[model samples]
Target: MRVTFGRHKHPRFETYTLHNGIDIDAPLDAPVNAVHDGTVAFADQFLGYGLMVILDHGGKNHTLYAHLAEARVQPGQHVSAGDVLGTVGASSVEGPGVYFELRSQGKPQDPLEWLAREGH
Candidate 1:
């Protein structure tokens, strides 16, 4: 997994503060998968996120996959880890890659930490 951008504060943007997620570089149309078992909470265009999919993993844990060329899942759909949620698309502010975010209790968490913990 090539991470183009990571979770951190950006001093360059006047209004933008922190980047709550990581941007993984992938070829256009590459399949993007669910990080864990969850139910699709949302699957549609979301502001600058473009075509995105938000997964609800219960316990207020959620995972968001943005910049998708196509969404394979739908709202309320159950998905296991590694299930195809969508395909990578050039819809991000950073270019052609997937913007991934992990949240707990509605707060952003470091996805790299979680991925490392999962041995990814």
Candidate 2:
């Protein structure tokens, strides 16, 4: 996990609340993969999120991929762990990298804990 969830000061906001996910540095257009088996729930441009993809891992668990250069999967498409979902990119609001999050019931969880448990 590169950037963790926490308070941050922003030039415009004065004080930014928290990061919803971890940021992983990657080259522009580098492939982004799924961490678990799931179906693509969303794939489109989201406000402030840039190009993004959201995968539903069942049990209300989900993974979000942001700042993507391109989305490879579509809604309802089944994907397995390690399957490529998109390529990393940077928008005006962010830099070249992938913003990742693991959520259960819509609540963000520590990705390192989850990755470690999964033997990543």
Candidate 3:
């Protein structure tokens, strides 16, 4: 499942380091949709991630979507892939863009593996 964004800029310029997942270059206000079916485990601001959403896919697997312009989901809410969870935006003064990640067993993991395995 390929995620889409609008002329999105990569977050490589930002100092905040991200763990894993696809980083789409979506301009501010672009709609950010879910990449997979899961439950919203976290939907709020963090020190670096800014406005973000974390979805739990069960079996200790989860995904983190960050640097959002707006968050539409909430903790404990269920969401499926392609579900619009928020809008991409400049969450930090550092710059504008998204920094996504994937995790397993409470640790960050390579999103490329999951994405490739799942044929995204």
Candidate 4:
């Protein structure tokens, strides 16, 4: 998995702003899966995110998947971890990749810290 961009203050044009998510570079149409079991909160085109899916895992924890070519889930749908949510698309501000974010109580958190490491 190639992580093109990480959660940080990225320089854009003349100013720098916090990038609340991480961008994982992938081939077009690559499967995008849910990181955890959750109910789909939203599934549609949203601003610069292009086609996106937001999953509410309860307890104020949520995960977002952006830059999708198409969404396979619908709002209010329950999805389990590893379920395919969509396919990677070239709709991101960077390029062809899936932009993922984890939020707790509406605040973005580093996904790397929450994701399981290989072999663990």
Candidate 5:
């Protein structure tokens, strides 16, 4: 759970800040997959995140993928579990990896909890 959600001191900034996601250590351009069946909610560049994709998994649960090399799905597209959504990319600060997050009813949830539940 690298960079787990919540407040922590920034490595570069030297100040406490909220980190809203986990950074997975994947090589650049490695395929990134959807953890559950969902509809693509957003796929575009976001400040600080680089290229990003958000999946709406219903029940108000959404998953986020950031620092993507490319986004393969479009907004409103349906995706199944294991579907490739993009490839990992380098972020300005995080370097080569994928930043992931889960949210339920607009509140952040620990992705490690989800991953553990799924036996990933």
Candidate 6:
């Protein structure tokens, strides 16, 4: 849940951007897991996101997983925290890393603030 930049060269800033990005070290084709309970609302190829997954956590809250090498879930899927949703990818415009976003009521929000201490 902690927002650690997937690539140190590209630090996802908060002052200019509302989203938080990070890298998952599961390796090439490593399994990706959901950080919390949510329903898959979008599962498709996004612009700079490449293969992406969006989960609606309900109550006007959502989580987005992008730049994946492989996606294992589908739209409308109900996933729990720690559920395997996809695999790590190496073809993101942001480089070989996972791009994460937390949205509130369809608007962008900071993922670092929502993550509990000792976040994964």
Worst 10 residues of 4 by lDDT: 1-10
Model 2 regions more than 4 Å off: 8-16, 92-94
- lDDT of model 6, residue 20: 53
Which ranges in model 1 have alpha carbons more than 4 Å from their true place? Answer: 1-16
Tens-place lDDT digits, model 5, residues 8-111 = 98679899987777888888889999999999999999998899999999999999999999999999999999999999898747578899999999998888
lDDT of 6 by residue, 79-106 (tens): 9999999988977644466778877888
Maximum-TM-score candidate: 5
Q: Write the per-residue lDDT of candidate 3 for residues 1-120, one digit (tens) a residue.
A: 133322334468645443345566667888887879999999999886789899999999888888898899999999999999998878655456776778889877767677779877
For model 1 the local lDDT of residue 31 reads: 96
Error of 4 at 6 (Å): 7.0
Candidate 1 overall Cα lDDT vs. reference? Answer: 0.88
Off by over 4 Å in 3: 1-22, 92-94
Cα RMSD of all models vs. native, in order, equals 2.5, 2.1, 6.1, 2.7, 1.8, 4.6
The best candidate by lDDT is 5
Structure candidate 5, residue pairs in collision = none
Model 3 has an lDDT value of 0.78
Of 2 and 3, the candidate ranking higher by lDDT = 2
lDDT of 2 by residue, 2-119 (tens): 5776556777968777877888888899999999999999999999889999999999999999989999999999999999999988962546888888899989888878898999
lDDT of each: 0.88, 0.88, 0.78, 0.86, 0.90, 0.76
Point out where model 4 deviates above 4 Å: 1-14, 117-120
Candidate 2: global Cα-lDDT? Answer: 0.88
Candidate 1, which ten residues in sequence have the lowest lDDT sum? 1-10
| Winner on lDDT (1 vs 6) | 1
User: Which digits, one per residue and each the tens of the lDDT, describe model 1 over residues 1-120?
Assistant: 445334444457644346788888889999999989999999999898999999999999999999999999999999999999999999876678999999999998889899989987
User: Which candidate, 4 or 5, has the higher TM-score?
Assistant: 5
